[model samples]
Target: MIFTRFTLKWGKRHWALVTCLLLVCCLVMPQWASAHAYIVKASPGENEILVAAPERLTLEFNESLQTAFYDIKITGPDGNQADDGNVHVDADRPHILETGLQAGLGNGTYAVNWKAVSADGHPIQGAYVFHIGEPSGSPAGLSDLTSGSGSTGGPLKWIVSLTDWIQYLGLSVILGTLAFLLLRIAPTSMTREPMDVPGSYRLLWISYAAASFAALVSLPLNTLYESGVALNELSWRLIGSALKLTSFGQIWMLQILIVMLLAVTILSGYDRDRSIRARIWSSYGSLVLVLGWLFTHAMTGHPAAADQRALAIAMDFIHLIGAAFWIGALTAMAICLPPLADKLPSKVRGEVYWVAIRRFTAWGIGAVAALVATGIYSSLIILPAPVLTSLFTTAYGLVLIGKIVLLIVMLVFAWRHARLARAATGSRLSGSLKAELATGAVILALAAVLTHLSPGQPAAAGPYQETKTTDDGSAITLQVSPNVTGENQFEVDVKHADGSIVNDLEQITLSLTHLDMDMGIYEITIPKNDTGVYKAEDYISMPGRWNIKVHLLTKTLDALDAEFEIDTTKP
Candidate 1:
């Protein structure tokens, strides 16, 4: 095979040296990983009732945001545009987004809708409402405004995940197969003529082609994601703007360029009769290009947003290479070993299998060590000690747990194969090798999903409280305990003007409306408790602005209404 012919003539010492260097690279540097951008502060503040209309709307995120493909708008109670329609990031602070509102705004509720791209290229968006003077009901069709606009859900997310899986799989195959041929097969077969495994070479080509195609496809997908435009609305001009303006687009372009160069190098230098020095140079050159390609993946992922960005990126890079070395090499062995074994004499084939298995076992040990070390560091960085308890409860953590489980299964298979190799029975271990490769594929798929999910933290907990005065001068205090996206306790206390509890109401009816999406109204009746506090328990199905309307009826057939807005968040 052309790829096998380009394998480097490195001994055991060289392999050990490279492994130590990677370990040093990981241990010497460390940083805290940061996930997608979220609102840290807002000008009008969520659910704040203002005495006067503000001239501008501003939002600040926890991290610096991308300049390209961001939006900030304000809509009035009449469902018309309230902002000047010119949104911009602050010149001095890239994390802050601001937009000017129209002059002489009327007194009513207003919704601030925003969308932004994080530094690591993930798209994040949300909506919140702040009343200009008093809480009137939300504007008509307000819920339909930004519905399904977030890139976090829908068919686009699944498509992005699929592309990520393909890219990871393809890169693993390319890097792993090369490592296997150079470290395991070439050293032992140097004295013999090179093995003519056409199937093995074909696999490498297919992987390379797939990786290249995925890299190309990701360009348009990323454009769609960042720009927040419909698929049908995507144009070459928008794509060009994204490529020229965003960090993600630049990194992707660099990766594609490297892949093209790597392809050219491989095709132009494929000669079986090349000199030893030329072969060594070609092998080292290809290795550098492949490592560079892997580096781009690290640069555009979560690690790039870490506090200690350089070290974090280095660790991520090493982690990816280790995965490729283990999973990719196993795949190569599954394809190449059987064919090579069939072509040799029975006695010679048994000896070759034993030697190949032993060498691969050594490589596996090093790869596993690197994977474990890097994996632990990444886990700590992504899920800090404070949030470690949420590991099994969160989407990111659950996917990580699945990957760890598969890794354990792969280790068991490796251990069994190692035992056979040590006993000189490695020739019968093809089934175990295939099983390990299949498990690794599942692990990679889980990893793809993990990349798309935001790490979970302890949900923000507290009572959402508000007080309003009815037309009759009665004080109405409403409180929703732990106002998150789940079941919550709603307590309403009605007091006379003199501060004594009023226990004469006929009944208390509570109406809940989701201000972000049109899920319809949810009504609940609150019974007066022994303490004279009207209370009820109900569920808040999703995260967003919620309007709770309280109706109180006196025993004399008199009715009074009070409304409170509660901003419910995700748990």
Candidate 2:
């Protein structure tokens, strides 16, 4: 009600200004947007036959991407690199990426292998061919280079998810404990100090320590998450480069500052009655630290990609603060406040409980409103009208739905607790508060996964996906590309029965069958290849796993069929 009144008093002009700012962000904010990042257009173009080779290669995408991760390796007709300099993002345009080409070349064909990560934090990659004079053969190394690009799969995603949950959970405890001490216990205590409840200090310390530890572990974990690399074989070069060059690196470095400041703020105790100015100044300083933390968080997540740059960030900040206060305060109430209250005289219990309840409920109402509003706003940003159906259809949507369900359950408990707080002298939300915290953990985990999920927006390009090798020995390498439902490119690298490269083959045919549906056999033409490599392009109308049979024929050997499955997970 207070927030509502404030908004109304601020007038329609302020709201209009907010709208205009959002419009700017939506149209011009390069830092804050994309559902999925992909190459929108390329200089040479995909599978183009050009009379002359381009002097420079430029790639444009739908999203602003970190150039640190954008790698370009152009192999010419002679199986050698065609480019001279490192790829760089266009100074004026963040989405436009370019690399200068090495000249003096007689080209047959060239393959551009690219890998880039969106600012919103999705990996994308592709391999495309362009002919300078005439097509000779498929570029050999490229097939392997682009094989498993753009996939956010494997165990690392889950590990990243776990780390994210810890960070948020720990934040909740810090905010909740600190708020409770400063607001409720400290005001009325004999010392009129923030540490009236010694248990509150302990709670704050544990949460602070846990959060700091999570932050330390998460840097490497986040780097691994971004690179989609295995822990044992993580590229130190990649981590080092990211730390030095990327926004994520900048955010991590800032987190270090925030951690130090937060520790200092907590250590500098407050005696409000003795020195209100110092206490007020310290609170202001803490606010700045909190804002910095929120800003850094937004820089790495959806808010960076949101259309209205400032508005989106504001929403993210409010959402975080609200959730942290509500969840953390409840946790502190259940853990720290109750025992302290028990130690107090029975005469004072009623007054303390009622007053604390009044203050918290007011805070809770505001927090709940902010969470609900921002959650909806963010959802709309991620999933627009037509594709909004994906809110139920996609895995991302399903997880969001689950989060909403848990929130609704907590809201119901909250309504009951509010009534109990007003009516009872000895307030007890013990069971309900615990339930809320438990539900909140799951909510944060779901959120961690949700942020990583592709919103399946129209702007999003197909998932860059791959399939595991069917066999170990001299087996065919099958790449099912742009791993979303649509026209998919299937490239088969023919390896002999003896695990040797079969560059000379008489006949190679590729056939497909829908594994999930009753759709029968469908075969596509195998393009001309002097090499044993078989390339096929066809429309895969729907998503899901589909079985493909690659039939190989030779003059000396009998026919052979290699099996692999294509998983078109989502668009």
Best by lDDT: 1
- Tens-digit lDDT track for model 1 on 494-518? 8888898888888899988776445
Instruction: Give the clash count for each candidate.
Output: 0, 8
Candidate 2, residues 1-571, lDDT tens digits: the string is: 0011111122566556555545643454233244656555677765567788778988877668776766788888788889876688887898887899888867687877777777676666666666788777766444533321244545777777777778788888777776776665232453335555647667777887887888788778777777756778577797787788777787888898899998877665444354655764575566456556756766666666666657777777777787878888777777765665566576565444445555677667667767776776677676634445667666667788898999898888877666666565453444666787888778877877776666652223354433333444456677767766545777777665576777766677767666643444556557646766677775453344568777766666765567777656534
Q: Predicted candidate 2: what Cα RMSD to the true structure?
A: 10.8
Tell me the spans in candidate 1 whose CA falls farther than 4 Å from its real position: 1-32, 140-151, 184-187, 190-198, 272-276, 457-571
Worst 10 residues of 2 by lDDT: 1-10
Clashing pairs in 2: 22-308, 25-307, 26-307, 32-304, 32-305, 32-306, 33-305, 474-499
TM-score of 1: 0.78
Question: Which residue pairs collide, candidate 1?
Answer: none
